[model samples]
Target: MHATKGTPDATRFLELLRLSVSLVLIIFAQITITGFVGFFVVFLPFLSSSYSPGSLLTGMKFLIAGFAFALPWLGYWWMMYSLSGNGRIRGFFLLLLTSYLALIFICMQIDPVYNPEAMIPGSARESTFLVCMAMSAVILFPFYSLGVYIFVLRPVKRPRKRYRFLLLCLLFAVAGLVLLPFLWHSAPIVYPGLLSFPE
Candidate 1:
């Protein structure tokens, strides 16, 4: 049998999953916005044509990134634990780090198959983007409930009112997965920019 929801093991496991997904999103969003230095993306733009930073700048970048990324996450957890009136447990942060690294390794090992060229008729970039999105919609179908639990229900301060407003989120997430194949043909129409990118 599964551990009850409020039990130590259950709570810890839920937090681990939430932290893993949130951190993965954070790392990727930072990469999208800043393109380097990973997580907080605090690295300075290249001062030399070689597209690299000096040693001092590199060190400074890492220092800033570490604090920038760590502070907010720590603050959120601090607030959470404080609200729950629980003593801080330090080891899970290390475990979270290990989980994030494992996720990175797993993602790197995935060789994405691209098949949108015929349907979307766009640059490799957009097609690849769409393919990844479609795959996510399909593969994550089962875990949408887990996502809702992590992102929505668990965060609610009121236990009784949790999931009241989030039923649609779960439905839409599942619907996308179910409809992706039928929707693939009209993707170009749906995403006007899909055809705008130069091949």
Candidate 2:
């Protein structure tokens, strides 16, 4: 078997972009669902207490959550724009998506709303939502993964400073996973008066 080493296919990279766009759209749809249709689910026993156990989770609530959850993935895609190596690009994005989803699931378990009964400590309904979302995200990974590889193959040189910033962002990305638990645990206590549906 011969290994091919060179620039990635531009068409394939475009496909990854499309996949990323689709994932973003899906996240938006979830925002709408949790916002507009969430009321019914919120009223339900497990659904309400499951993820939004702390306070009422309105449409806006899910919108922000979805955006925040998707940020890491989005940031990663953006970061790829800076580099021109297809292999590194693909590997990095794959790592980013996987790591981001992992952190989300971990936070769900650590947070309150996800698992209300406290039957399982460090596990909640948020985790369940993330698990499902990650499954959906899995469908798009291949394209984005290919994009990363394509990126690495491209011919270009990065500035030293930009490289530094990319490195910083990468570090931040890793730190996000470590810090997510603390953020989830402290968010409610830090900010009371969570938003709710109109009375």
Candidate 3:
């Protein structure tokens, strides 16, 4: 009797552990994808031009900035996932957020080519962008949490279906798109220079 009783508990614990590990893997994958995309986009412009010491240095700076920008979001996602206790919901939210971030970063990279002033480090515009990104994160966190709670956690008359998750994802994507312009406007410019670069 005791052995049978313990089996289910042990199995449940193992299942929770598996979910936790899977979430961590997803987070790491997100970070890796963002880093690769950032590096490639930043390096793309230099490919057509003659190699210069400055271009090489700029590429390295972009890579570092990409990682720095992504690390905070990783923590935020991990915390949200742990709190939500719904791997599917967490995955959806992370996907949405990562896509939004990648899009913004790509735009930032392209913007500097036409308007060099946009990428100037430590400038007011750059600072506003960072502030806006941070603000977006703060604003979206609760919205996602509540969304998961209402859509997935709360009891409903109808049986929960996979399509509901898809719906939630679509809704979030739309909301993200609606707010993206504002976010992008306030987004910190990623310059091809080091943090210590003279203002």
lDDT of 2 by residue, 82-195 (tens): 453442454444444554454344334432243334574333344433333333233333343343334322435564434544544454444444444444555545322221
Clashes of 2: 22
In TM-score terms, candidate 2 sits at: 0.27
**Candidate 1 local accuracy as lDDT?**
0.42
lDDT of 1 by residue, 24-119 (tens): 654454333222224223123542112112234433433343334333443444444455544433333443454345434433443333345757
Q: For model 2, what is the C-alpha lDDT against the true structure?
A: 0.42
Reference-based lDDT, residue 1, model 3: 30
Please give the RMSD to the true structure for each candidate, in Å. 18.5, 14.7, 12.0
**TM-score, every prediction:** 0.28, 0.27, 0.32
Cα displacement (angstroms), candidate 1, residue 154, comes to 22
Cα displacement (angstroms), candidate 3, residue 116, comes to 14
lDDT of 2 at 21: 64
Q: Point out where model 2 deviates above 4 Å.
A: 1-57, 85-88, 92-97, 104-199
Instruction: Report clashes for each candidate as comma-separated counts.
Output: 0, 22, 3
